[model samples]
Target: MDSREMPEPVSGHWPKRSSDAADHHPHVDLRPDGVTVRLPTPEVDWPSECDVTLARQISQAARELDVPADPAALQHLNVAVDALVIPEVLPFWRALLGDRDKGPEDLIDPHGHGPSLWFQQTDARRTGRNRLHVDVSVPHDQAEARIAAALAAGGRLVTDQNAPTWWALADAEGKEARVATWLGRD
Candidate 1:
């Protein structure tokens, strides 16, 4: 929630954080072990809708202890994830967000209220661990249009049996993304 939407505690005391926007700085280490970690937090002024979804992702991971997190802590935190895809994934998500293309190789939420995911071009196919990935859900009728849009932009189509309900899709380099259709539903 933005400062406006953050509910005050029953005691009516909220953290005295300033009104300045949060900066999603990259994690780096000047320490001896040289360990670095990016802490995922909500960017200030983020759209409530996007923040809500990100909070759900954070909470899901937190519940499984996959990541030590507090959804509440995400308030005013700026978090960004980069996706190095074959360009096609960008338009798919842009369309999903009902956003116009931001640039030749990038798209940003118009409101500047959501985490900025940078989609980059890289030659290496995704191997063992993905630093980041993306997924989407679309109506069945819109699936082909979505895929076509992605392909036109630079994405490739893929399918995997383990995931039966949705068509598996990937970038031209084999880095995977997904499109699940809301078809035959209640």
Candidate 2:
């Protein structure tokens, strides 16, 4: 059966597309809370020349679905924590949080109720500050816009050592988070 016939969803609507054309579209993730419409790489600056093209394609596909597109409900988030000893300490966190292994360095809430936890490898632990850092993964195309939005809200850029992938930023009080993208990651 095609995606449309996968089953009428109980919560979220999928943007309809022809089975052959489906490969060109973003994925629609149906969750208990809401739905996330995501591309392999997020497009942040909507209305840009490139984004406009993508937007049109999505709009067309969404129109075919006969469902009102709700861009407002389309944001996805992931939390990442930097760690000095992933091999030694990951197990502790897994047991404490009752998380299951997603990979060699990641743990996930099997029920999808909690933010996904990814352990980033770091050489040394931070001295005074907390070692845990939050990483917000968005569609790759949305990274710039998300970063700009954060900065506009008083978040400071800590480092852009990795661009189009992740940008380390801190809040007014220096609490840290990174706006991440799937680019260069997979």
Candidate 3:
């Protein structure tokens, strides 16, 4: 079947693009609760040390809000965690990734997603979050339509950044998400 017959989905909406075209759009949802979560945009000037500090900051803020930051909230990423591949999880994911699993560290998604949803090993784990998150990116022209599609797919508009060419989108459960349209690597 042509890709048009099987367009990829963001969250749950049927986006208006071929599966190949959707690759240029990446959406990562940090949905702790399974359905909704807040989306976190990549720190443009990302530093290795930031994850730890950011986790701490989120925890402290959660205390102020009377809601604790579940370690899973700070741990699990909707996308691939690290470039390193765990042989343990690779086989299952390999089958899922199909021909894309040509090598370790190669990004793979059975769903025609943007990047390899890396499962970075972590120490802490906790209950799921109340919100779901997604990182979405599409072609410049497809940006608005893609965002609208996300809204149709049980998503809610969270935030947007005009300069960096990204939009922070979320689901109905207050989950975090991002919509970024950029050149695809694969």
Candidate 4:
């Protein structure tokens, strides 16, 4: 499934269920900002039927409890590190970050509190730009508003050629960050 096909929660909560048919319980994480339900595995682009059903149930439960959902407020943050030799740098970050979970090009926080780390491989050495940047992945519909807010706060658009997927921006001093979405990624 593409980004547009992904199911969204109705009450500002993300619900997830195990792919295992034997596990009937949905794990839910309640936070001050919102609720996140997770399975043993990370979220997939296309969720299973059970996952969708559990998401709906979680939404219903939230509504019953009068929980309001703010789609604009729902976002996931990650740190992107551009490296020419990822293998050489990956170990240091993993050790420094306290060893949670490692993917081929990413490091995820097992507890889901800290932002995930994504390593981008680059052939040429980058100049006049940061090697590390923040990636804020928000709902597709909210990207524009978020970009506008950042711009109004003195940030400038570095590039939007990747819009609907991401927009690179920079602070006054040129520190970079990207507002991204799952759109355009299949």
For every model shown, the clashing-pair count is 5, 9, 33, 0
lDDT of 3 by residue, 126-147 (tens): 2454222344444345667767
TM-score of every candidate relative to the true structure:
0.29, 0.65, 0.34, 0.74
Better of 1 and 2 by lDDT: 2
Q: Single out the weakest 10-residue window by summed lDDT for candidate 2.
A: 40-49
Runs in model 3 deviating more than 4 A are 1-88, 107-136, 152-154, 159-165, 174-177, 183-186
Off by over 4 Å in 1: 1-131, 160-164, 184-186
Please list the Cα RMSD from the true structure of every candidate, rounded to 1 decimal place. Answer: 16.4, 7.3, 18.0, 7.1
Q: Which portions of model 4 miss their true places by more than 4 Å?
A: 1-27, 31-66
CA-lDDT, candidates in order: 0.43, 0.62, 0.43, 0.70
Clashing pairs in 4: none
Q: Which candidate order results from sorting by lDDT in descending order?
A: 4, 2, 1, 3
lDDT of 1 by residue, 1-186 (tens): 222232334112211111112322222222332222223333322233333343344345333433333222121222123455646577776787668445665555555445344465666655663545554544345556666777788877766453323565668776666554433322
Alpha carbon lDDT of residue 170, candidate 4? 99
TM-score of 2: 0.65
In candidate 1, which residue pairs get closer than 3 Å at backbone N, Cα or C atoms, i.e. clash? 42-77, 46-113, 47-113, 88-155, 158-168
lDDT of 4 by residue, 44-100 (tens): 322345544654575565555565556676667889999999989998999899985
